[model samples]
Target: MRIIIKGGIWKNTEDEILKAAVSKYGKNQWARISSLLVRKSPKQCKARWYEWLDPSIKKTEWSKEEDEKLLHLAKLMPTQWRTIAPIVGRTPSQCLERYQKLLDEAEAKEGADLDLTGPTGGDAGPSADDVRRLRPGEIDPDPETKPARPDPVDMDEDEKEMLSEARARLANTQGKKAKRKAREKQLEEARRLASLQKRRELKAAGIELKGKKKKKGMDYNADIPFEKKPALGFYDTTEEKNRQIEPGFTNVHLHKLEGKRRSEINEEKRKKKQKTDSEGGVGFVPARASQLNKLKQAEQISKRRKLLLPAPQVGENELEEIVKIGFAGENTKAVVGETDNVSSLSDYTPSSTGLPLRTPRLIGGSLQTPRTPLSVRSLRTPTTERARLNRRSQVVKRDLPRPVHVDELTIDDLTYEGSEIEKIIDLEMIKLLKHDAIVYPVHGSKLNSQNLESIESFEEFTDELMNQAREAINAEIKITANESDLPEDWPKFEDLTGIKQCQNQLEINRNLMIKDASRAAKLEKKLNITLGGYLVCYKVSRSSALVKKTLESFEEVEQAKIELDSFQSLNLSEKVAIPKRIETLQNEVDHLVRREHELQERYATLLNQKQEIQLRIEDLFAKTNGNA
Candidate 1:
């Protein structure tokens, strides 16, 4: 079965040849060539041989020489990285990363100089200053040139004089107090002159003006249109200017004359219109025809409807039983009474007394209940029998799906609720019991271990058999209950694809046991199979799921115990110190947040105050200038 790895024809059969070759080969040679086609599955064997070849494979040791070389080359020429990367067989980026790491290490060293004083410095050498000074009124100045403007304060005397004049002119023209005073004086003078002129004009015209007839200023013809009124069927030829009417008796007399003339003209036009309409003979015919048709239809509908009878004029107490259901016509009452005459089809007429239709009455000496259909009565027998049987079965058989550990033994024997014995059972036992029973029933204080062991074995079998029994029992129970049942949707754990996980775990546990056994037998002159260790090993073998769970539980218990011990081990002051520290931190944070809010509020208030003060100062300056 010998085979050389490279040349094909000279080798033995592929799998057999590989197995033989691996057996003969040295460990170092096997590691490098394991990927080649082999006689048998070579991964594990090849790995084992490779591990044998290099004892350091168990714990790989880093070489100081290689580490130093990488570090030196990395730091020497970091920017020109590709030049030195080939020495270490890495890319430029990798070299750069290594250089950064070396830089970090150099920084961490107590007295090491980070300034890599090498033949070539790296990219982080000297930085150019990125700031520039601005000239007056100049933005984005050229880096190579000097700025071109002098500062405003350095202006010549002429410019300063011009600026002062501009400011003075602006102050005089825009000042509010000066402008208001000037406007008030102008208005007073204009009003006095206007009143005097009006008095002079009224005296010259020999007319007395009342308060409502006082004249406005002499802008006469300011509101009239630029056209003269027509006179006697002829338009005026002259381009007349607009004229304003004076508020006096003269204007009132003129308006009254115009109104009287217009009224006379309208009366004459109306007389002509009435004469023409009488001759035309085509008015109101369309409107009257529609009105007559609507009246006729209303008359026909009224005649077809029956009139309701009027109610008897009686007091409220006299008409107690005779209910007035509705009024007929405008004021008539329609009443219904038990003895009132009404049409009846089958010797039983609906009562007019407003009682319920279904209420039985002693009519013609006969009593009858409302008839029910036959179909409804016939459908009840099977349903009621089924319900009664279900209730009886439920009374006889009442069991809930419980956890395997708790369910395996009955309440009288094992304690249904969490008693002492129930606590001892593992959680995995609970999970298993959820699938099916884990133990047979037992009695007495002396527990029967044999049957319990058998039942445990039965619990661990593939779920196909146990599920069948469960399905049958469920079907039977559903039948007894006469109710449709829900189907199980979750996968059975034993039916799941990952059971290989449990097998792998078991294999690892067996290997560990074998190794420990061998070590004990060799070291202490003790046999590999002791009763105590063997029992523990047997427990592991019996339920790998449970053993794994138990180990995790023990770890958690140990952690909890450690935490409890640490709590118990605390000194009195130390325990109290934590809460005090926390309180101090919370108070500090609260104070800081309050201070931050206060500062923000103060900043806002100060900004508003500053603006208000600026406005007030501006107003004061304005008033001072106006006075000056």
Candidate 2:
């Protein structure tokens, strides 16, 4: 047989030629086989043998046992299909294809398992056994019998309805199962492709693929040193050594003596006390009688020293005469000479000529010498008078006074006539009184209706009568005054009467108003005092209430503290049980977390299935359009 290859065309003769060549040369000798087949390349011959001519190629579904064997060989020799082919009883290409299918299925199953173990998936799906158990019974009783064709007769309505329902339910369950399988297959393919891409990326980055190594168990004896076996004994001895030291060392030397020595010390202290008592209790010291008498005499002398001494006698007339002539120039020399004589003389003595001596003593004491008769000059002017005259002589002199003139008065004297006195009357007094008055009149009559109506009390009525009297007096005075004699600013009789009445009314009103104001002010002050007392009382009450409330709150707090203490004094079992409860709750929380993970996975699967269905629908639409 002969074959031709031009523009990828193949004929029945080509297949025959390839088969015949393969049969003669075997599957491996692609070059020899190609030489026998004319117009065919060795590569082409090899591809044809593996793809079509080889009887070992698995066109049927791979069984479980075959799949397991393939997986085992693939794991032992990854990507080495030629080496694994004979062991699996398949061609290299067939082995490779089966291994790849197994890998895709494994990846899909892993992806589905991963989705099932997620944070929010529902409970696990039914297993194969559960699915089988849940499968409905067969409708037909006979194993080999098919349902016969429906008779031409009409069926019972109930039977028809039941059949239809059964069909619908069966259809629904089958559709759901098919959809689940399709979704699982799609997920497997997607995860497989993703895993492949990840491996490719890792390979490109020069990272070596390796499995996680298992950790070895801990060796407890590794860290212990044989030489240090007695180190733990050191801690035990340390505690004993610490205990041997006296705990009462701090108070051991507090007392100076102890036991029999303490009694001896007490006896010595008693002896000391007895000796002190025998010696006047340690603080008594007796003074001599003579020393006491001397101290008394010294106190008496000091008291006598403070008594007033009699002043020297001098005649008032003599002292006055000295003061009068003290400032005279002629007496100045005499006064100075006397002062010198007084400074030089130490004591008064009788002179040889029978003159009395002036006694000299300290200014603070009396003279101790016997009395001598006074000299004529000394009797006339005493020592005090002489001293006064001398002191006056040392004073500075005053200038002469200026002369006074009686005719040079600055104020003028007044002369009064009987007629002028009569005219003056009380006009000045009235004007002064008017100026000092607190109330002034408005330009209106006091007898007006408004004024009358404004009088609200008896006081106001009396005020009106007084105003009328004052107005009459003012009108009489104005009427008696001549126009030429009247002041320029003075009003006429009628106007003056009206003004006086208004002033009187205003004054009365002012006094009445002032009395009311004073009363109101007194009332306001009383009210303020009452309010202040009330505020003080309120503050005191509030403070007391606050103190009471605070104490009550404190009591409550103390009670709560006591309760807390009682609660804290619980049994060891109860305390231990609390942690157990916590652990159980933690376990429950872990279980809930797993449940939530399952729910999330189920939701994700549903979402993925929805998306796949949408994609399939889109593909179907595309295919329909393409067919059209």
Candidate 3:
């Protein structure tokens, strides 16, 4: 078997395909983008984009300032092209290449000067471009950072297949969603025709079936699906419903009597509706279920109702008795000097003559609370749904299709009675069909919350039914997968690559966070020092509302004391007297702290690595022992 490697200088076809893939799937989906180009990996696709093909890359000739800044930054942060690239407004590869080119020019200049003084060779060595150029049969090491070569007139079969596959994938704008919608539409049309045919057949046989117009399909209690209307003219006709044409033709015939599709009938009806609507909006059209909701709304708005208050509580007799009690209390208080308790003047009932309790004021028809004597309205939403679920479940159980044997059952042994065996076979077939319905859902049916909850908690099934379902699912998957044309292991590879990239990013971010934390501490210290003098000076000069500022300054002072103490062990007198020496000492102290932090970080990393290796060794030993 011949071994084939999958990367080299990118061709024109591959480059174009890559560009199209990126536009479709985007830069983040490098695995998907690279799948179009058989020769490139995800990393290569990403590098190609960032290093050369990206629109954001500055491909123009390098300016003098850029060169100077590049050299300055390069000297300051050596071998950190990745860090310097963003600051230089370029990619890492571009920065490195430019830096090397400048160095080569300087070296050549020095060599020219040397050649002037001493004897030189007759032939000049290869130029920088030629020196780096790949020989025939030798792969280009950094092909991603180079421009794509021109494409040949004829493409290889594999390349053609890949192109076609990519084209097909991209062209399918709707994908699974479109396929689902199409299936739903077909199912709906089939259901409508089936219903119409049934009704026609019944009428033809002289059996006038009178079924109520339902708002929902199968789940009759659910809310009707309505098309939302745009805000419109006065009197609000937004509640108008779409009308359907119930075909009146008795039979299929020639000329105008020829059978028309449901869509055609609807289109004809719509044209008539438009004509009626154009005639100054005078007509009221009814839905198939019943009258238009707009008519009901208009009627409700037009009507006037009597103010019917809650059935009059505290009738004439009760009111009269209450007034008499109040008068008696006042008269008794005025006549008698005062009771033992002066506050008792308000109470006419001397514990014995307390008025009899009357029934609570009649409110809306709801059950009253026992202790509080108040009517609490029930929450109908969940209760109504629960009721519907119970109703539906009962109906489904009661009205399940009576088992009529379609296939004849014959047993050579005749171990069990024929009726008993037939009944069992029917039950198993019913269960199988139920399983199929759950697994392969119908497009026409809509499930409410009750159905969804019920689905989640299913009844027990026989092992035979489960096995049959499993086999069916597997068969379906196999048949569909043949047309998908994807490598089976590619998805696993993508997952691995994603996890690796994420881990790499986490490490980079961790380092950045550590660096930022240290820098922030330094900045915070400097900030407090800079602002500390202002607060002190202001408080000394001013009197009004200076406490707030003084407290702030005090807090800053305390922080500064802590920071300074932590900074150095030397006392004020022992510290360096000279300004430059003080500065140098601070710099040295900072350098040592930074070095310590870096060392600690490295130690932690090495510790983690050690643990990982130890675990791996244990795993290996366990596996070896198991094998033995």
Candidate 4:
């Protein structure tokens, strides 16, 4: 039989029993221990021993060395607390907790130390311990501080080996340094000699070296002698004296300047013409002028050539003019000019008013008809001729039958015989005909009938049934209300306080069950009455009640927990009103401080005045004593 150790705090007897069982059965054999103990399971027994009963587990404050070791181990193996726990002589959970605490402290310290805008305005630098841990090759850049070298006597084996290697390196570097010094000396001598040669060359060439020339005196205008210097004035007249004076240059009119420039240009052209005439006109003329003269000669030659060419011959029909007479009877006649045989239109001359002379001609026995005037509407219909022409040229459109649908049958229509139709009857139709014989009346046929008495009787029956159901439901509701009513003995759940009180009562009941079971076990041992036989069942029921009460109270506890978490997580101002109020208090403090300082100064002044008065009074007393 499994003995469930329900909701009871561990007692000394239980602890002793667990310890003995653990000792006898070993730590890992929790199932055997649980069986031996009879009141705890493997999980419960293990938790009891490790959490509270274990003597090896330390619950004391962690030492500095232990903390350092834990931190180092944590850095070496992060999150593996079980590995570090043994080395630190603590449980894994304790080690993890201590490490977290240390880390938080270090972070806070770092934050406080690293204030960029604080009084120091800079970091205080690393700690002395960190500096001491620096390697030999790494040196602080501060001039006052020197890199630490390990003493041979104090050095470990590794350090000694490093020192020997460093000494060898130093020796090699010294040799290289001496060679480098010799090379540098040679280079310096070469540079000195070259610079001397360069200076000699410059001096031979009479070139002065560029550098700052020293002034005779510190005064800015020391070059000007005191006696010969002009009077000090804001504007200098030296620039005016330096300007050139041209005769009749300033006040010349713009028109006169333009006329003078034109005359000068004419004189230049006349001189050029004289020079050309003196040279017998064989001097260069512009290529464009020569080309123009040649073009004119070529044009005159082309005109002579065109005049020498014969005129084209005209046909008789083309030369003959056809003229129609309006009232004269038609008699064709050809009129020829006396000077020219063919009187062309080009040869005809118009009068001075630019009007042409109209002459009538007779045609072959017919009268000419006058042209009719065009209508405005005919001019507006621009597309009429085009549309008519298009319509005349268009092909005629004939109606073509559309293709018939594929489902439409092309076979000839024929009437079917009755015998053939009968042979082709549908299965569904036959089934329906067979079903018609056994078919019952339509649904609700009786209800649809106009029998008022029967309808009233049915409604009365439904009303009676509804009333009976309502009464039954009302009785059931009353019974349930009575059953659900809280007894006077039952605990209240109105508030967190009442719920907490109920939780406490449930805990007490659990404790009582544990006590009673223990007592019953003792009684069973003393007598053979089997008193503890029912205790298990009783304990189970009590545990269930306790669990139910705990679960019920859990909601309140959870709410409180959430509130606590929210309170803890609140920022500085929400958590407390101090920060905002502190500003006002700080202002008051500053005001008080300023007032105190002013009062101090005033008191000092008053003290000085009192001293002066006291001295006067002493002097007066002395004089009065002297007179007396």
Regions more than 4 Å wrong, model 4? 1-13, 36-39, 50-52, 111-628
Per-residue lDDT of candidate 2, residues 1-628 (tens digit): 6344411333344565556655544578877655544445777666666655567665655666788898887888888987887787766766765676666667659868888433434665554334434246534222111112333246556435644553443344335577899999999999989977897899899986764656487546765434555544434466666666657665666354344576888999999987876677334334444566889999999887666879969889978876665546345555666755643333233456853477677577987566555523442247655644433211111222211211221222112234655545444333222222212222331233332322331121243565697799899988796777566645565577667666756876899899999999999999998798787799789999999999999999999999888778776568889999999999999998899789779989998999999999999989998999
Highest lDDT scorer:
3
The predictions' CA RMSDs to the true structure, in order, are 46.5, 46.7, 48.4, 53.4
| Positional deviation of residue 593's Cα in model 1 after best superposition, in angstroms | 9.2
Lowest summed-lDDT stretch of 10 residues in model 3? 401-410
Writing each residue's lDDT as its tens digit, candidate 3 over 198-271 gives: 99999999988888776445553554457487577667445555554457755646756757888999999999
Candidate achieving the largest TM-score = 3
lDDT of 4 by residue, 542-586 (tens): 989999999989989999999988878776447477777888999
Error of model 3, residue 149, in angstroms: 0.9
Clashing pairs in 4: none
TM-score of each: 0.14, 0.17, 0.28, 0.17
Q: What value of lDDT does candidate 4 attain over all alpha carbons?
A: 0.59
- Candidate 1 steric clashes: 10
Candidate rank order under lDDT: 3, 2, 4, 1
What C-alpha lDDT, on a 0 to 100 scale, does residue 173 get in candidate 3?
49
Off by over 4 Å in 1: 1-138, 141-154, 173-178, 181-274, 277-584, 590-628
Tell me how candidate 3 scores on lDDT.
Answer: 0.73
Superposed Cα deviation of residue 125, candidate 2 (Å): 25
